[model samples]
Target: MSGVVFLILLLLGLPLAFTLIASGMVYFAQNPELPTAVAVQRMVAASQSFPLLAVPFFILAGHVMNCSGITKRLIHVSNLLVAWISGGLAHVTIVLSALMGGVSGSAIADAAMQARILGEPMQASGLSKGFSAATITVSALITACIPPSIGLILYGYMGNVSIGKLFLAGLIPGLLLTLVLMLVVYLQARKKGFAPTQANPPSFKQILEAINQSKWALLFPVLLIVTIRFGIFTPSEAGAFAVLYACVVGRFAYRELTLSDITTSLSESVSDIGMIMLIILASGVVGYAIAYEQLPVSLTLAVTQVTEQPQLILLMALAILLVVGVVMEGTITVLLLTPILVPLMQSVGVDPVHFGILMLIMVTLGGTTPPVGIAMYAVCNILRCSTTDYVKAAVPLFIAVLALVVVLALYPPLVLFIPELLF
Candidate 1:
């Protein structure tokens, strides 16, 4: 009953947060034995989580770093490294996304930032608007897999997996995504006669100079992982450190951040934080309802009645996620599905950390597809490209990313290697 309500509300265009809350409330109403106050209590209890603190702090940190001179320096470094490649600006867009992933952690934020900064330039440099928008939107998936990824943090929290391990786990997959996407850009650039941003590769000295300028930005993610791995701070506290790091880099080191910029960043952070937290809070009710209904148990039984091979089970789950991801917001999907899916994976002898990383990528990738893909709408809007055209231009890049997902899915060791090595 609640599931039906959720779908109807979601399709009716109710905001996602409200859809979860309302659906959960309907579930309680239908039961009649459970008190409605449980819903309110559940909502309040959700905010009491300490680990969840990472979400807001990281979000604030991303906004602050964007306003600070960090983004500009990173952009310069990306340009120096990749501007000589075929489809140079496109490569820069992909590289900048990988770099921004370490700093921003939010795919939508990275996509929006790159679209604003690089969108027009790509088109002006003779790249099609559709391709430029697709590149900007899809490359942002790197942010979801990189260390300090907000998706990983939430997955860890909900599934009771190790945040530090998840952070470590994301490293290889993120880099692989970057490499594959760059290859796609190179091939597409050649076919389209897209010119390189530079006639020749950057000199060694020039590359060193650019890296020197962006050293602080580059050091942030490395320091974050080391601190977490060594028990210097929990992932939640690391979010605080990230904010401090961004502020110091922006205000003191680069001297580009201003009081006004901070005020604006805070304002934007509040909006993002509020939306995310509300969905989380509402999800508590939905989560409680699902558990009370023993959805996970029922799902496990239903799934196990089939072949029950761990790999086959994972593939089925991934297929469902890809479909739901198309119509749902990634965050909402994570909150709603994590509880249901994690235990199911564990039952079949799958590593939770491995499943979590794959889950994050799949859900995050949904935001780049059609229908309700928030990141897709954001980038297309910024670049003024139609969805149809964007999808057409993005097919090859999409296949490249999906191919990486398939590899990671079949070989769990690829996803788990760094986390196992460090932990």
Candidate 2:
């Protein structure tokens, strides 16, 4: 079966895109009744979506802002806001992630960026290299829930859910995470003697100056939501607006973006978009095969026969996803499994948007964990920390993330309240 081959190739360390393509090809090859051309057609059709255009546009906007000095300004604002706390840099890291999530949308990108930006400062302030690396990688989890999140976009696309709803759905959870992680850092930092960076919270003048400087970066998510809510822009159009907004902010407001920066952002976005879009295209073939197999229907009957309780069935699926996330990248997991899982949950009366947040969290959480955690490795490599130390440092944060996940899972309203109110 394609699933079996896909796992073997994955264990053999095949690239995710190629592994998807290969498994799809194997599926077509064996099923002589279905022409091989269908797989190719599926891949081609997958990336042709209009809602899907949000991925590239948002990606380019993120890259543009990255080069335009927006990141540094936001970091300054984060410091002004939170660096007086115990484990101040750690708190700042968490808060900055909440802020940056709106801008970057990519956890791996935010993690790598923070590990590079904050790792040294954390170390200089007496945080261990491993702790610094772990903080950045784990905090990137916050980014996975925030608006413009590529994972959410992909889930919305694959699951036939509203991307706008998904965006609003994430706002509260993302903020909740910011508070929870900061509390964890506060307690640990107190016991560990990780002192505050400042004597007190910033003066009003300082706060105003920081916000004034970074206001453009901060206003982006607000602008995105308003436009989408009022029908001023579709999600796809919102993405286009995101790109144009970033360009304006970079060139005029910040006066930091040069022609060279524009060229660099374009080059970076081309690479980033090509990589994500290709994987998406390859996933289309696998998704088509799953649909052709009636996998969701089969899962529904199988799960129903085992237990009809909605919560228990949902738990089982979440458990499977949590486990698989450790082995697979998040977006690939979303693309490959959303079709199969969304229907299963719908049958059980679990709200897909609720599950979407929980699912994205679990899947993205894996990227911050284990042997295959790309975000973990990225941060560790940047900070030159050993995998062993990173794991040890991550235990408490991992527990915090998992705990929040349980809360989100048990209380659907926590995830759904915003979407319900907005839409």
- Candidate 1's TM-score: 0.98
Task: Kindly give the number of clashing pairs for every candidate.
Answer: 0, 0
Worst 10 residues of 1 by lDDT: 97-106
TM-score versus the correct structure, for each prediction = 0.98, 0.97
Error of 1 at 332 (Å): 0.8
Full-model lDDT, candidate 2: 0.88
